[model samples]
Target: MDKKTHFDFVTSIGLMILSLVMIVDSYRMGVDVGGALYASPGMLPMVLALLLLLTSAMLLKRSIRNGGARQNLAGFVAWFDIFRKSRMAREMMVGALILALYTFVLAPRLPFWMSTSMFMILLMAILKATSLVKNLMITALVVGSIYGVFQMVFHVPLP
Candidate 1:
């Protein structure tokens, strides 16, 4: 298949996997609360995961119908080569890596606001989207807003 179709196929598979994981985790969170299914803490997450799974399945079917299933080893290799050589693809990969690092590494170790600020600053710096001072100001505003919303409005503790 073409690049777009190949990309869609890959993305669908990833989404399916992610949705499955979410489904499992949400299920483990307990699907029923006080005899009420909708009252469960996991209800919304489970519903969202199911929706994502359904959409991913549809995408997968469409990709396969559009010749994605005909892609062979050589074609896959060629696609990877093209992806590796593209500047946009490289930037996207870097951005994804940074997000993963922030989620899995930094968030677990640091306070919520501090980790979020660091993530925003690092991401903007790596993307060269703005000057350091501007990035810091933007990060501060965004994180402060998040903190205020969670702590004051929602009465929720951030971690």
Candidate 2:
């Protein structure tokens, strides 16, 4: 079996399931389009789920028609392949860990804007941003824009 096609198919199926779950959960939560668009709690999740479903369907179709990364993948899964093949694997793993920590721990405990700002700066540093001033400036701008759009404009509640 083509490795790329197989992986793509699996990922598509997984995403489809997740999308279905999100859609169902939103409906169960009484989120309905009959109400005003902005006030509906389920609108964003519904939209996101539909978008994911569409993308997953497209990926599934493409994978079925054209294979990706055709190679024998029957053997035991090589979990350390990233470490063996690339030098940036460690940094990538650390980034993922940092993201998880920020999401589960910091975001809930601290204010969203502050936590997000710290997370952005830390991510920039992790990605090898050399200048402290540049990283701070860029991260502040990004955090401000995000806060302004989500909290001020959209009026989404933040911790």
Candidate 3:
């Protein structure tokens, strides 16, 4: 199999495994107070697991149907090389990771403006942004805009 097919096969297997874990965890949650599917604590997780299973199955089916036909490992490797050499892609990936970490980990405890400002500043620094004035201005603009939207307009609590 070519690299693309191999990667897809592996991804399908990994998704199937993750789905199994989700299903098991949901099952282990046991019965809820009312013994109703809707009221059960496991309902959401079970639903997510079933969705994951279905998607993974579809991926696997599509991959098998395509077979090892037109995919070329050499071309895929060339594409990977292009991506690896792209500074813009790398910077964007770093920015995304920073945003994800702030959203998933820091935002829960830190104040919204504080965490977002820090994340924006740190991400700009990582991207080797020139002009300290520009960096600070951009950071303030983005962070303040987000804060205003969430806290002032939406009246959402900041954590």
Candidate 4:
């Protein structure tokens, strides 16, 4: 089997197993605020577990259909190549840092529109969007849509 497909299969299986473990651990934490007829702390874990299970199944099926051979050390070497590329690795790291920044700095106190617009604009700049006007317009549209969904429909409190 091809290297990428082999890694995909292994990663999917690993994630599924991890999710199952999380489900069990969360279940052991018991329900939230009640013993029965109420959502538990287990709810999120169960949802994650189901998603992981489905994703893993799909990956496994794809690998099988592609006639992937057994993975080996060479497959791991191929996986390591993802880290060898400086540009890709930097992008991945920067994206993760941006997410952390949003969670900690923006989510707490900034107004929904302000913080979202800022984040979206920054994302567009990072992606090297061609046109300034187009980027601004697209960001406006996206922020507006999210604002409508959160404020108008769900009526959720926004920071």
Candidate 5:
């Protein structure tokens, strides 16, 4: 087992625990006596919790069948060794940081379209999306489509 598989197992367990907590919290939120199906405050949480539970279960099963214990037995040093010179690991870390920056820093400060377009372009570049023209086209199309759906169709205000 390598870092990817080990990380998958760890993430599965963590998400399973998170979903269990969410389920409990949702139950505590209570069902409304006068509400229609899924009209209660707990409805969304319950749905998300179940989806997380189902997906994490599948991930755990797959990870266990794919030498999960070997990674566990390797210890932190061995795990660290796996990514000592890995460009992909560094890229992934940077990608995650970029995503965090987009969500927390850019999304709130900038207008929705500009922030989203910048995020899409940056992410595409990081992932090595085709030529420059193609990247811009994809980013514009995605931003336009999202803007159309939310602003025109849904008539929702964006940050």
Candidate 6:
């Protein structure tokens, strides 16, 4: 199998797994809540997960038809080497980790403004967007503006 086909095959499988997990979690959230599927909190997510599953299955079928299934274990190992060696891949992985941390960990534990400021600062520093002082100033301005708009203008309480 060629590189593109192999990559597509692996990506399709990963997406399929993710969609399945989403479906399971959504199901666990209670599809029949409020006595109707449409009224359920998980309805939209379940529908979206089903759509993702369908698309990924199609991609998997196409990749296999294009000879992606012919690849051996060594091909998979070689494909992963690009991530290990590429500087861009490392940066992208770090960025994703930071985003996941902000969404799943920090945002829930801290106030919205504090978590957002921290997230922005860390991302700007990692991306080398500017000096520390400038990064802090930008984060402060953005977070403060958002807080002001939501709290004062809209009369919404931020977590």
Better of 1 and 6 by lDDT: 6
Off by over 4 Å in 3: 15-93, 128-130
Residues 5-124 of candidate 3: C-alpha lDDT, one tens digit per residue = 645755786899999998988977754344767778888998999999999888777776766423533445666787778998888888889989998988887887788788878877
Q: Give the clashing pairs for model 1.
A: none
- Against the hidden reference, what TM-scores do the models get? 0.58, 0.50, 0.50, 0.50, 0.54, 0.63
The sequence of per-residue lDDT tens digits that candidate 2 reaches over residues 109-140 is 99877888888888889988768899989988
- The residue pairs that clash in candidate 5, if any, are none
Q: What ranges in model 1 sit over 4 Å off?
A: 4-71
For model 2, state the Cα shift of residue 101 in Å. Answer: 1.0
Error of 3 at 110 (Å): 2.4
Best by lDDT: 6
* Candidate 2 global lDDT: 0.77
TM-score computed on alpha carbons, candidate 4: 0.50
lDDT ranking, high to low? 6, 1, 5, 3, 2, 4
Of the candidates shown, which would achieve the greatest TM-score relative to the real structure?
Answer: 6
* lDDT (Cα, tens digit) per residue for candidate 4, span 5-110: 7677777778878878887877776644556524676767677788888888888778756654355345656767767677978877777777777779987778
lDDT of 4: 0.75
lDDT of 1 at 110: 93
Q: Model 4: how far is 99 from its true place, Å?
A: 3.0
User: Model 4: runs farther than 4 Å from truth?
Assistant: 5-71, 83-89, 152-154
Better of 2 and 6 by TM-score: 6
The worst-scoring run of ten residues by lDDT in candidate 2 lies at 69-78
Q: Judging by TM-score, tell me the better candidate of 1 and 6.
A: 6
Residues 78-156 of candidate 1 have per-residue lDDT tens digits of 8999889999999999999999989899999999988899899989998999999999999999999999998989999
Residue 106 of model 4 has an lDDT of 88
